[model samples]
Target: MATRKAIVVGSGAAGLTAGWRLAQAGWQVELLGPEAQVGGLLAPQPVAGWPCDLGAHRLHAPALQVPAVAELAQRIPLEKRRRRGLVLVGGRSFNYPLRLTDLAQGLGLRGGGELLGSLVHARLSGRHWERQRAPEPQSDIGFGEFVRSRSGEAAYRAFYRPYADKVWGLDPAELSQSCAKQRVSSSAPWQLLWRPQRGEFLHPRGGFGAWMDGLAQLATQSGARVTLCQLSLQHGDLANLDADAVVHTGHLSAALTPDQQLAAQLDHRGLFLLWLVVADGQPGPVDTWYTPEAQFWFGRVSEVGNFLGHPHGRGRVLCVEIPQGRHAADRDFTGDLGELRRQLAQAKILSREAEVSEVVQRFLPAVYPLFRRGWLPRWRLALRHACASGRLWPAGRQGLWLHCNLDHAMASAEDAVRHVASGGASTQWPELAERWSEVRVRD
Candidate 1:
């Protein structure tokens, strides 16, 4: 009997996983990506004469939900990188997943005292005391109001407000509850004041994206044919072929159309990355630094040497991530690093002797979905429109438009398999599908 043919588009984690799964399940699958190398943004490109990634990327909290990814990681050269994370506030550092004491410390003696008082006041007011506070008896509010009501205006102004504005590229008030819950959370201030712990951190031996080629090999060995190419639908990236089914693993907005064009265009945020190679040594208290302060344009910085143990032929690499674009039309994708060298020197993260060996600026347009205020309604609407397309199954962060880890991306592909087997009518692949038009959709 002839094999059941399938075509997988975009060779990112999601695409590779989907293609591999479909092939293992007795389907003839072909995987294609925009680059000769797999891994869209996640691919670990060589920077500063060693194997480094776009920024400090890691696989946190393994997805037991997807056995394939979990199994693959175990079999692969994934080393456990146990580095601490800290918050840089007003030039002071504090532990992350933030404990009450740390929060107080980050706020400093004066601001800390006020935050503690506010927490006490909110606690006494009995607003968030209930496990479930019935209903607001009012219309839905936004992230700003949610934080204020749960904690107090003081905490919101001190932390939540600035943090939200800095990291999300939008004011808390302008962000919807759904986006907030998806990103931060809507819990009351007192409840969230305590520390939040993160899961294990994993990185590949060579680099995070290094595993893509291996995955392609594994899938091929398992009977799937993996091909590499610069592909897109409109420009005929895949113009030569037709198959029984097409598994879209790139940006869903590319395949999802006319009806959702507005939402698709408006919902995603472009990502800007700046990678600097430090000759001296590791900097900062942790492997990753999260600063929401106005002074630091980049929200987070990750030291690669701390994770991979300072590879040969290069100095320690520091990857700084600016949450949004500086200007609307900045033309630097991977350009000069001299401009930001002063900022790094001032912060002391980079030493006076440390020379900026190389700078790689990657501007990924629409890499993240803007989980903005009231974005839930339009997101659901858009997903519904895309899912109704039937043949095209969108998977992964870019495809699903959700903020997720590598595990979620792999699991999303697992879900996509169920949809492929059922010819897109499966209850799984698209998130809001099963609950479509139900109370959940409206919610």
Candidate 2:
């Protein structure tokens, strides 16, 4: 008997996980993607004689609990450390999660007193941000409202609003608050008095690329054929394809056929990355540093050498992330290496006389799902069409238009593989949609 065949689109973690799972289940699997490297966000890019990931990437601890992830953990052991992140707001440094006491300290005595008073007003009388839910998925309020209600106007102004503006490119008053739920964790006010606890984070021994390579090998060894640099089928490419199922881990915007009018309704996001090769001892020990100050164009910088314990042999490397809107202007990409060096010197992350090597500039397109008010119906309409087609199964961050972290992406692949195995003949679109929607995620 001929083996059941499956074609998995986009060889990122989700697609590779799907390919491995299907192949293990006795199906002949084929994986395809546009890029030669396979990890997606976690995929490490070589720099200055060592590996530097797309940005900062670590196996979020919450994701280690997933069966597939747990299994992968055993295959490839990684170092676990307390995640240490820093944030600079209003010329003051604080913990990345904004611990209550630290936030109070950052605000001077008078400002802190005002913040406390406002908090009392917000919690005792104002609408509880968490309790107040949007009537419909598409009708959710902006992230600013929730932040103001939760932390009061003073706190919101001090940190959240500026951070949102710098990172998301959307005014806090415009984008959906659901984005906050994914990124920020809400703790009890009482917990503010207590010191924030150190939590575990993971990284591979060599680099993120080693971890991705392990995952890719697992799929291939299980009998899945992976084709690098193979783009997902456009109209003409679909003609010769024959498979029991097709799993897409690429952009939904690209998946839309010429006739899908709702395609324009959904807009994804883009990104700019400035990776610098600096002297080994220049940057500090922080894994991630975020700034809400307007003077700095980059929002977050992660020290790759510190995170993975593997520097490029001579000096350390840093990856700075500047999240851009899907429609960011062309001029945004025009800065030169000298400008970047100047910015680093200005920020004091590096010295003016520090030995700096090549500056790699990257522009990533259609990488994130950008949601606006009343976007659900249009997004779901596009998803519904993709689902009803009976041939396509969308998985991963871009595929589902969710900002899923490393672990959630793998779990999504699991969900997609299971849905596809149920057979396309009698599949229900709502059920598939619900499964993807329900998976709990960390940003």
Candidate 3:
């Protein structure tokens, strides 16, 4: 149906970026996605009067500074703002990211000693911290085990495990080290041991969907064709697609046939976002907070209206994040606010009583890709070989079979464009392989 074109298979951050890059490089690109909305996991869903994001969709400082990501964010109007964060530990609340003063004075002597000792242990394990060639089979070990060995059990249990568990919906032992390498700072020894200055998250003036749609418009306007509801992989339609190269940037399983090993690594999880619209005009303290305590049904909670500017000075919008398990199917936050309210009240975190406005749940089959041990070497090799073969190239979180933030996904597009510009030459696949092989947790 098209000549000398590139096809990208997902509409999320990865697919959109790949399409835009190739289109800008003078290739006619067709972007395919199942959802009508372009931004995949990055897109926002409406809750009450505000946007409730299931993923940590905010652009952190280090990620925001990336030129490509910054360029994308600038497409929409955004405000530079900061919100207070708190961590509830030992029945007390302390400033999150562990401010120096809070750690020194707030945590008291014993907690401070343990935290300092943990930092020291991390520094001592030079191999573990730097992510160097592991003395132990690095890939086979789970993230929790690795952290415990290097950073001490307290740090892993008190801080890393709970926070990561809330986001990934799996125990640290189940997730691979590669899945989280990019998110954490250096594990290097002899480094100044303190929490780095926390980065801020972005909130679009209107909603996250508006920002995603803006990018989608750019891709389509640049001779990039987009199709929705075409979820067949039988290759029957392959005869209809006449393209020099194809960028399979959608979900790995959806874009590629299920016979591939890369597709086999997909990790599915359930997400429940409970939005509480308080009539008293009071919201939660922090923009976002993670809960690992089993007593609480929700893992993390955030206040949207406060995070996004309170333009109208209206009521507050609170979003609670919960992972899906067997009990998730029948869980009702609307009727379960009694538990949430009780927690907040017990902690003295909220003065006024909060009420539930709406509840939203999404069960994602492959929300994240876990780069387990014995997995990356082969998967990476296959993708490299596939790209060289010219018919298949990975895109997005699942496509690449790596864990990447929004910025990294966009960076992937830049790499895809470089490959497309080569015009399907055999030399191009080697070059593409080199580029993909270089992909790390960060850009």
Candidate 4:
């Protein structure tokens, strides 16, 4: 056999796994990325001598059972975090999923009616959406429309619109429902009404980045080389970088040269997160809180200091997340920690004297692909055709143009191994494809 090798670009979970799998399968692999670190968006922060994750950190329990993720988990310490999400709306507190009893009690009869209407709409619409075996929408429709149609006007205003607007920085009407379906947890009126107890949240012992760091070590030791400070793809040049095969994992925008076809296929998302280290405070939940009322500048706020351990360690570290479109650095702390503190005070979630110790801002671009309905078939067709060529292959969120979580990225890596071993890629691997399709999304 010719000394087989492969080049994997981007050091995120997807890139790392692809590189690792191929290398483990006896093909030399070279992994490249744009930053000094290996974990793509899953990077970590240091708060008062402890690790804090700024990006998606926790893993659902179901993810651990996967062989690929399990291997990675074995090398690192996985710890479970508790759930305690709260919503501060209309000067009242609703549990994470929005409890029916709480909503009824807090909002009185009128609020309860609105909540009930949303529930009925969601149940009816959700069934309609799932039953449709025909083609989905052609052009993108806002999540607001879908929610209102399926769940009711009040539901859209109280839950869907506010949540979408805060996260994506666009009217729910402008944003694609594909993103909403992929990212947010499904909530029928009944699900919200019941307020079920979800499973435990998981993260690395030190930092989420630590998990990647450990995975990278395994990949490198298995004969895969990870390189940073390199960008752009030049056909045969990528494969020639001391490897036999190549996996392109960067955002498609970052990979492809200017082309109209490439541009249209590549819709993207931007992200802005502000990290705050505060005195004598913590996130007080598993890892997240969503702001549907838009009282704060951030769509979501996370107390990573608590999940990563080091709770009450002199200071608290919180990450305030804003979708990239509306997040301007010059803007007045758009829903960031400062604003969050202000709102917390108003909601009585925090005391008047509470102050932020430090604030840091981070911006990310093209983190998500804007895939509209009916686009998936065409996308799958194109991807199938492209990968069939055996040279240019899709990898990562942009390359695949789909939503994925960290474990899914690693699973992609494992799939690459199977492809290399079998001498090609195929949809025949139904089980593998289904597994890949279940990846989580962290914003």
Against the reference, the lDDT scores of all candidates come to 0.65, 0.70, 0.60, 0.64
lDDT, candidate 1, 253-321, per-residue tens? 665555566654446666577777766554544687777677766777778776665465545778887
lDDT of 4 by residue, 1-443 (tens): 77676778888888887877777888877787888788877766565555666654678776786676888888896887676676776767777655766776788788877777666766765543333322245634546665566666776677667776666666666665665566654554455555565746777787778888988888898898888875656534443455445677765443333452463465666677677677777455545666667666656677766677655366677676766655653454534445567765675545668676677766666675665444555555555543543554566555566688776666666765676577664333322343444343643
RMSD in order of candidates? 4.6, 2.9, 4.0, 3.6
**lDDT of candidate 2 over 88-128, digit per residue (tens):** 76566777655766666677798778777777776776565
Question: Model 1, residue 231: what's the lDDT?
Answer: 52
Itemize residue pairs with steric clashes in candidate 2. Answer: none
Q: How should the candidates be ordered by lDDT, best one leading? A: 2, 1, 4, 3
Model 1: how far residue 224 lies from native, Å: 2.2
Model 4 misplaced regions, further than 4 Å: 121-129, 133-142, 230-243, 261-265, 282-287, 311-313, 329-340, 347-350, 372-389, 425-443
Task: List candidate 2 segments past 4 Å from native.
Answer: 126-129, 132-135, 185-196, 235-240, 259-264, 280-283, 325-343, 424-430, 438-443
Among all candidates shown, the one with the greatest lDDT: 2
Candidate 4: C-alpha RMSD after superposition: 3.6
lDDT of 1 at 238: 32
TM-score of 4: 0.86
In candidate 2 the C-alpha lDDT for residue 197 amounts to 61
User: lDDT tens string, model 3, 1-443?
Assistant: 34466777778777887787778777777787878666777677776656556544466566676555777677786665575666566666766554544653566788767866776676566545555533234355767766676666656666667656665657677766654454443422123345465555566666667778887887887778888765744223432456666676654544334465344465455566666666456654466664555556665567776566663345776666666633445566566666767775665544444554445555454554544445555564455544544565665565665556667777776666665676555235534443443344421
Cα TM-score per model: 0.85, 0.90, 0.82, 0.86
